[model samples]
Target: MSFFPAVGVGVIGVLIGGVCLMSQRKSLFGALLSMEVFTLSVYIMIFSVVWFSGSLTSACLLFLSFGVCEAALGLSVLVSLVRSTGSDYVGSLVSGHF
Candidate 1:
Protein backbone atom coordinates (compact mmCIF):
# COMPACT_ATOMS: atom_id res chain seq x y z
CA MET A 1 0.00 0.00 0.00
CA SER A 2 2.88 2.39 0.73
CA PHE A 3 4.87 3.81 -2.16
CA PHE A 4 8.14 4.41 -0.31
CA PRO A 5 8.54 0.98 1.24
CA ALA A 6 8.08 -0.71 -2.10
CA VAL A 7 10.55 1.59 -3.81
CA GLY A 8 13.07 1.23 -1.00
CA VAL A 9 12.83 -2.54 -1.06
CA GLY A 10 13.23 -2.65 -4.82
CA VAL A 11 16.29 -0.42 -4.73
CA ILE A 12 17.93 -2.40 -1.96
CA GLY A 13 17.22 -5.69 -3.68
CA VAL A 14 18.76 -4.46 -6.93
CA LEU A 15 21.85 -3.02 -5.30
CA ILE A 16 22.54 -6.07 -3.18
CA GLY A 17 21.98 -8.41 -6.09
CA GLY A 18 24.25 -6.42 -8.35
CA VAL A 19 27.03 -6.25 -5.81
CA CYS A 20 26.85 -9.93 -4.98
CA LEU A 21 26.76 -10.98 -8.59
CA MET A 22 29.47 -8.67 -9.86
CA SER A 23 32.06 -9.10 -7.13
CA GLN A 24 34.73 -11.78 -7.57
CA ARG A 25 34.38 -13.26 -4.12
CA LYS A 26 37.34 -15.56 -3.42
CA SER A 27 36.90 -16.50 0.21
CA LEU A 28 34.24 -18.57 1.91
CA PHE A 29 33.67 -15.62 4.23
CA GLY A 30 32.84 -13.30 1.38
CA ALA A 31 30.48 -15.86 -0.13
CA LEU A 32 28.73 -16.38 3.18
CA LEU A 33 28.45 -12.68 3.84
CA SER A 34 26.81 -12.12 0.49
CA MET A 35 24.39 -14.98 1.14
CA GLU A 36 23.47 -13.48 4.50
CA VAL A 37 22.91 -10.11 2.91
CA PHE A 38 20.63 -11.68 0.34
CA THR A 39 18.66 -13.40 3.09
CA LEU A 40 18.31 -10.18 5.07
CA SER A 41 17.09 -8.33 2.02
CA VAL A 42 14.42 -10.93 1.43
CA TYR A 43 13.33 -10.75 5.06
CA ILE A 44 13.12 -6.97 4.93
CA MET A 45 11.03 -7.01 1.77
CA ILE A 46 8.65 -9.61 3.20
CA PHE A 47 8.35 -7.84 6.52
CA SER A 48 7.60 -4.51 4.88
CA VAL A 49 4.93 -5.98 2.66
CA VAL A 50 3.39 -7.87 5.55
CA TRP A 51 3.46 -4.77 7.72
CA PHE A 52 1.41 -2.96 5.15
CA SER A 53 -0.99 -5.87 4.69
CA GLY A 54 -1.30 -6.55 8.43
CA SER A 55 -1.34 -10.29 7.89
CA LEU A 56 1.05 -13.25 7.33
CA THR A 57 2.72 -12.78 10.67
CA SER A 58 3.30 -16.51 10.70
CA ALA A 59 5.15 -16.31 7.42
CA CYS A 60 7.47 -13.64 8.71
CA LEU A 61 8.24 -15.64 11.83
CA LEU A 62 8.93 -18.75 9.83
CA PHE A 63 11.23 -16.90 7.50
CA LEU A 64 13.14 -15.41 10.41
CA SER A 65 13.63 -18.83 11.98
CA PHE A 66 14.87 -20.27 8.70
CA GLY A 67 17.27 -17.39 8.18
CA VAL A 68 18.76 -17.90 11.62
CA CYS A 69 19.20 -21.59 10.95
CA GLU A 70 20.85 -20.87 7.61
CA ALA A 71 23.34 -18.47 9.18
CA ALA A 72 24.26 -20.96 11.85
CA LEU A 73 24.79 -23.67 9.25
CA GLY A 74 26.93 -21.40 7.14
CA LEU A 75 29.11 -20.48 10.10
CA SER A 76 29.64 -24.10 11.04
CA VAL A 77 30.63 -24.96 7.52
CA LEU A 78 33.05 -22.05 7.38
CA VAL A 79 34.71 -23.19 10.59
CA SER A 80 35.01 -26.73 9.33
CA LEU A 81 36.51 -25.56 6.07
CA VAL A 82 39.06 -23.37 7.83
CA ARG A 83 40.10 -26.11 10.21
CA SER A 84 40.53 -28.69 7.47
CA THR A 85 42.13 -26.54 4.81
CA GLY A 86 43.89 -23.96 7.03
CA SER A 87 42.19 -21.30 4.94
CA ASP A 88 38.78 -20.26 3.66
CA TYR A 89 39.59 -19.85 0.01
CA VAL A 90 36.70 -20.86 -2.23
CA GLY A 91 38.99 -22.68 -4.63
CA SER A 92 40.47 -24.79 -1.84
CA LEU A 93 37.35 -26.88 -1.69
CA VAL A 94 37.66 -28.13 -5.27
CA SER A 95 41.31 -27.72 -6.20
CA GLY A 96 42.99 -29.32 -3.19
CA HIS A 97 43.92 -33.00 -3.44
CA PHE A 98 42.84 -35.32 -0.70
Candidate 2:
Protein backbone atom coordinates (compact mmCIF):
# COMPACT_ATOMS: atom_id res chain seq x y z
CA MET A 1 0.00 0.00 0.00
CA SER A 2 1.32 3.44 -0.89
CA PHE A 3 0.97 6.60 1.17
CA PHE A 4 -0.36 8.55 -1.77
CA PRO A 5 -3.25 6.19 -2.28
CA ALA A 6 -4.12 6.33 1.39
CA VAL A 7 -4.05 10.10 1.36
CA GLY A 8 -6.23 10.21 -1.73
CA VAL A 9 -8.80 7.90 -0.17
CA GLY A 10 -8.88 9.93 3.00
CA VAL A 11 -9.32 13.18 1.13
CA ILE A 12 -12.06 11.78 -1.05
CA GLY A 13 -13.87 10.33 1.95
CA VAL A 14 -13.70 13.64 3.77
CA LEU A 15 -15.02 15.57 0.79
CA ILE A 16 -17.91 13.19 0.23
CA GLY A 17 -18.80 13.15 3.89
CA GLY A 18 -18.68 16.93 4.09
CA VAL A 19 -20.98 17.27 1.10
CA CYS A 20 -23.45 14.86 2.65
CA LEU A 21 -23.41 16.79 5.92
CA MET A 22 -24.01 20.14 4.25
CA SER A 23 -26.71 18.83 1.96
CA GLN A 24 -28.67 17.10 4.71
CA ARG A 25 -28.33 19.47 7.60
CA LYS A 26 -32.10 19.70 7.82
CA SER A 27 -32.38 16.06 8.90
CA LEU A 28 -31.06 14.95 12.28
CA PHE A 29 -30.42 11.38 11.14
CA GLY A 30 -28.69 12.60 8.03
CA ALA A 31 -26.44 14.84 10.08
CA LEU A 32 -25.55 12.01 12.43
CA LEU A 33 -24.83 9.64 9.58
CA SER A 34 -22.68 12.22 7.85
CA MET A 35 -20.72 12.85 11.03
CA GLU A 36 -20.14 9.13 11.43
CA VAL A 37 -18.83 8.93 7.89
CA PHE A 38 -16.54 11.85 8.52
CA THR A 39 -15.24 10.28 11.71
CA LEU A 40 -14.63 6.98 9.93
CA SER A 41 -12.66 8.79 7.29
CA VAL A 42 -10.53 10.46 9.93
CA TYR A 43 -9.92 7.11 11.59
CA ILE A 44 -8.87 5.63 8.28
CA MET A 45 -6.45 8.47 7.69
CA ILE A 46 -4.96 8.08 11.14
CA PHE A 47 -4.60 4.34 10.73
CA SER A 48 -2.82 4.82 7.43
CA VAL A 49 -0.45 7.30 8.95
CA VAL A 50 0.27 4.92 11.76
CA TRP A 51 0.90 2.10 9.34
CA PHE A 52 3.45 4.14 7.41
CA SER A 53 5.15 5.55 10.49
CA GLY A 54 5.21 2.30 12.55
CA SER A 55 3.95 4.10 15.70
CA LEU A 56 0.39 5.12 16.46
CA THR A 57 -0.33 4.61 20.12
CA SER A 58 -0.84 8.30 20.69
CA ALA A 59 -2.77 8.76 17.52
CA CYS A 60 -5.01 5.84 18.31
CA LEU A 61 -5.72 7.24 21.76
CA LEU A 62 -6.60 10.60 20.30
CA PHE A 63 -8.84 8.94 17.73
CA LEU A 64 -10.67 7.08 20.49
CA SER A 65 -11.15 10.27 22.42
CA PHE A 66 -12.41 12.07 19.35
CA GLY A 67 -14.90 9.34 18.58
CA VAL A 68 -16.19 9.29 22.12
CA CYS A 69 -16.59 13.04 22.23
CA GLU A 70 -18.34 13.18 18.88
CA ALA A 71 -20.77 10.42 19.78
CA ALA A 72 -21.54 11.87 23.18
CA LEU A 73 -22.15 15.38 21.97
CA GLY A 74 -24.17 14.33 18.95
CA LEU A 75 -26.38 12.01 20.94
CA SER A 76 -26.85 14.57 23.68
CA VAL A 77 -28.08 17.17 21.24
CA LEU A 78 -30.35 14.65 19.56
CA VAL A 79 -31.85 13.54 22.84
CA SER A 80 -32.39 17.08 24.00
CA LEU A 81 -34.04 18.03 20.75
CA VAL A 82 -36.39 15.09 20.93
CA ARG A 83 -37.28 15.78 24.55
CA SER A 84 -38.03 19.42 23.92
CA THR A 85 -39.98 18.97 20.71
CA GLY A 86 -41.57 15.54 21.40
CA SER A 87 -40.46 14.47 17.95
CA ASP A 88 -37.21 13.69 16.18
CA TYR A 89 -38.17 15.25 12.91
CA VAL A 90 -35.36 17.51 11.84
CA GLY A 91 -37.62 19.53 9.59
CA SER A 92 -39.58 20.74 12.59
CA LEU A 93 -36.50 22.30 14.12
CA VAL A 94 -36.11 24.65 11.22
CA SER A 95 -37.76 28.02 11.78
CA GLY A 96 -38.37 29.51 8.34
CA HIS A 97 -38.32 26.88 5.62
CA PHE A 98 -36.92 23.54 4.52
Candidate 3:
Protein backbone atom coordinates (compact mmCIF):
# COMPACT_ATOMS: atom_id res chain seq x y z
CA MET A 1 0.00 0.00 0.00
CA SER A 2 1.26 3.49 -0.91
CA PHE A 3 1.35 6.35 1.57
CA PHE A 4 0.39 9.00 -1.01
CA PRO A 5 -2.58 7.00 -2.26
CA ALA A 6 -3.88 6.65 1.26
CA VAL A 7 -3.47 10.37 1.88
CA GLY A 8 -5.13 11.19 -1.41
CA VAL A 9 -8.05 8.93 -0.60
CA GLY A 10 -8.44 10.60 2.77
CA VAL A 11 -8.43 14.04 1.19
CA ILE A 12 -11.01 13.01 -1.37
CA GLY A 13 -13.19 11.53 1.35
CA VAL A 14 -13.11 14.82 3.21
CA LEU A 15 -13.97 16.68 0.03
CA ILE A 16 -16.89 14.35 -0.64
CA GLY A 17 -18.26 14.80 2.86
CA GLY A 18 -17.83 18.55 2.71
CA VAL A 19 -19.63 18.76 -0.62
CA CYS A 20 -22.50 16.67 0.73
CA LEU A 21 -22.91 19.08 3.61
CA MET A 22 -22.59 22.16 1.43
CA SER A 23 -25.25 20.95 -0.99
CA GLN A 24 -28.02 21.65 1.51
CA ARG A 25 -27.77 25.44 1.15
CA LYS A 26 -27.06 25.57 -2.57
CA SER A 27 -29.25 26.02 -5.61
CA LEU A 28 -30.21 23.06 -7.77
CA PHE A 29 -27.38 23.64 -10.23
CA GLY A 30 -24.86 24.13 -7.47
CA ALA A 31 -26.07 21.01 -5.69
CA LEU A 32 -25.72 18.95 -8.84
CA LEU A 33 -22.18 20.20 -9.38
CA SER A 34 -21.35 19.29 -5.79
CA MET A 35 -22.79 15.82 -6.36
CA GLU A 36 -20.53 15.40 -9.38
CA VAL A 37 -17.61 16.39 -7.22
CA PHE A 38 -18.63 13.79 -4.67
CA THR A 39 -18.89 11.05 -7.30
CA LEU A 40 -15.52 11.90 -8.82
CA SER A 41 -13.96 11.74 -5.38
CA VAL A 42 -15.38 8.25 -4.91
CA TYR A 43 -13.92 7.24 -8.27
CA ILE A 44 -10.52 8.52 -7.20
CA MET A 45 -10.71 6.52 -3.98
CA ILE A 46 -11.72 3.38 -5.85
CA PHE A 47 -8.87 3.74 -8.32
CA SER A 48 -6.46 4.34 -5.49
CA VAL A 49 -7.30 0.97 -3.89
CA VAL A 50 -8.10 -1.25 -6.89
CA TRP A 51 -5.60 -2.45 -9.46
CA PHE A 52 -6.85 -2.34 -13.03
CA SER A 53 -7.63 -5.94 -13.99
CA GLY A 54 -10.04 -7.38 -16.60
CA SER A 55 -13.19 -7.41 -14.47
CA LEU A 56 -12.15 -4.46 -12.38
CA THR A 57 -11.33 -2.45 -15.49
CA SER A 58 -14.80 -3.08 -16.88
CA ALA A 59 -16.35 -2.19 -13.56
CA CYS A 60 -14.38 1.02 -13.35
CA LEU A 61 -15.50 1.98 -16.82
CA LEU A 62 -19.10 1.32 -15.93
CA PHE A 63 -18.75 3.36 -12.79
CA LEU A 64 -17.31 6.28 -14.75
CA SER A 65 -20.15 6.00 -17.28
CA PHE A 66 -22.73 6.26 -14.54
CA GLY A 67 -21.07 9.33 -13.07
CA VAL A 68 -21.15 11.10 -16.38
CA CYS A 69 -24.72 10.03 -17.02
CA GLU A 70 -25.77 11.27 -13.60
CA ALA A 71 -24.22 14.69 -14.18
CA ALA A 72 -25.94 15.06 -17.54
CA LEU A 73 -29.28 13.96 -16.20
CA GLY A 74 -28.99 16.30 -13.22
CA LEU A 75 -28.13 19.19 -15.48
CA SER A 76 -31.15 18.47 -17.66
CA VAL A 77 -33.40 18.39 -14.63
CA LEU A 78 -31.94 21.66 -13.40
CA VAL A 79 -32.64 23.29 -16.73
CA SER A 80 -36.23 22.10 -16.70
CA LEU A 81 -36.72 23.28 -13.15
CA VAL A 82 -35.25 26.68 -13.95
CA ARG A 83 -37.55 27.00 -16.94
CA SER A 84 -40.62 26.21 -14.86
CA THR A 85 -39.74 28.04 -11.63
CA GLY A 86 -37.71 30.99 -12.90
CA SER A 87 -35.19 30.39 -10.12
CA ASP A 88 -32.76 27.68 -8.97
CA TYR A 89 -33.10 27.94 -5.18
CA VAL A 90 -34.73 25.16 -3.15
CA GLY A 91 -37.49 27.34 -1.79
CA SER A 92 -38.59 28.23 -5.31
CA LEU A 93 -39.84 24.69 -5.83
CA VAL A 94 -43.33 25.50 -4.59
CA SER A 95 -45.95 23.74 -6.76
CA GLY A 96 -49.21 25.50 -5.89
CA HIS A 97 -50.64 28.59 -7.61
CA PHE A 98 -48.24 31.43 -7.02
Question: What is the TM-score of each predicted model, taking all chains together?
Answer: 0.79, 0.79, 0.74
The 10-residue segment with the lowest total lDDT in model 2: 89-98
What is the Cα-based lDDT of residue 39 in candidate 1?
78
lDDT digits (tens) for residues 1-98 of candidate 3: 56477648747775875667585684877777677767777777666555532235656678889999998899888888778888888787666723
- All candidates' lDDT scores? 0.78, 0.82, 0.72
Model 2 lDDT tens row, 1-98: 68879877888899999999999846687788888888888887888888898875787778868887998899988888888777767868766432
> In lDDT terms, how accurate is model 1?
0.78
True-vs-predicted CA distance for residue 93, candidate 3, Å: 1.6
Pairs with steric clashes in candidate 2: none
- What RMSD, rounded to one decimal, does every model reach? 2.6, 3.4, 3.3
Q: Where is model 1 more than 4 Å wrong at Cα?
A: 1-3, 94-98
**Runs in model 3 lying further than 4 Å from the true structure:** 1-7, 10-23, 52-56, 96-98
TM-score: which is higher, 2 or 3?
A: 2
